[model samples]
Target: MSPDQIVVTVIGLAAIAFIVWFFWLGKRLGVKVAVNSSGYQEAMVLVKGGYTPDLIIVEKGKPVRLNFLRTESAACSEMVMFPDFNKSAHLPEGETVAVELMPNQPGEYEFQCQMGMLRGKLIVED
Candidate 1:
């Protein structure tokens, strides 16, 4: 291969590696819900490029309140959906929106953006 071709191939390979690491092998931030004075398990999730604490843990059979603060104006981040709980919320830019969930059984659930680009997980424990 020519010198130019080699450089291009290397760059392409690097880009592919970055994408894989970012989307799959990156470090995931997890937050365990805390029971607030209002008696609800709550956690604040920052929304920008993605959910800050993408992994949320809470106890089953309790109310879980996830406060999502959208810091970016990206259209893809406007909405968050919890398919398992059939709950969703519109997150306005520069404002906070609360999405509540009640997990009667201990299991793992998924939450994502409207486009499913940004994703998160909710783990309900016994």
Candidate 2:
């Protein structure tokens, strides 16, 4: 095998490992999750574009999981926001990546896409 072939193989395996680990850790954490996407006209209104379940409620200690469901061919859904935790993740297109946020205090944590068009709120209650 050539060096290029070996590198490609390694990269492929690494991607698989990352995916496996992502799902495994996600499930193990027992994160409370909600799915969102810009599927139709009504649904798009909630996210203002391509986000769904824009309004979420959870306990202070509980982790909030946003399974960013991207249905478009382009890579429009790039990142998410959790201002309370100061956390953000760059979401890849056509993938369901998860983001976990643990809000210690009871308040509303807001999130939006990079473009600021898509928005959501996490109401953390005590």
Candidate 3:
């Protein structure tokens, strides 16, 4: 092959490698958190409106796991929802369902029940 052609091929390969490496690094550094409502131990986070500790602290640019737990004795605990993330899922009674949230920005994101009675916040810190 010609010298110029070989150099071009090398550059192209380097670019592809760089792109893959960048994505891998981003994933590795991403944050992950898990919140379990109805959790036997961590169950029921009580939040009293504006600015509460219901705001869970998490690392910026990471994947968050929000676990919704429900009990058969409660009516509609399974219909919990989060408007901020545009997510709505009904979990079966006496079960745990996990939602994955990947927030790329550093900000406070609010999540609440469809009824708006239950609320929580995800506080991302850089």
RMSD values for the candidates in order, in angstroms, are 1.8, 14.6, 15.9
In terms of TM-score, how similar is model 2 to the real structure?
A: 0.57
Give candidate 3 regions above 4 Å deviation.
1-53
Please give the clash total of every predicted structure, in order.
Answer: 0, 0, 1
TM-score per candidate: 0.85, 0.57, 0.53
Q: Candidate 3, TM-score vs. the true structure? A: 0.53
On TM-score, the candidate that comes out on top is 1
Best by lDDT: 1
Could you give candidate 1's per-residue lDDT for residues 47-81 as a string of tens digits?
Answer: 99989899999999889999999999999999999
Q: State the C-alpha lDDT per candidate.
A: 0.93, 0.61, 0.58
lDDT of 3 at 10: 100
Regions of candidate 1 where Cα sits further than 4 Å from its true position: none
Residue pairs with clashing backbones, model 2: none
- Clash pairs (backbone) in predicted model 3: 31-62
lDDT (10s digit) by residue, model 3, range 59-90? 66656665566545444344656666787777
The residue-level lDDT of candidate 3 at 49 comes to 30
Q: Candidate 1, clashing residue pairs?
A: none
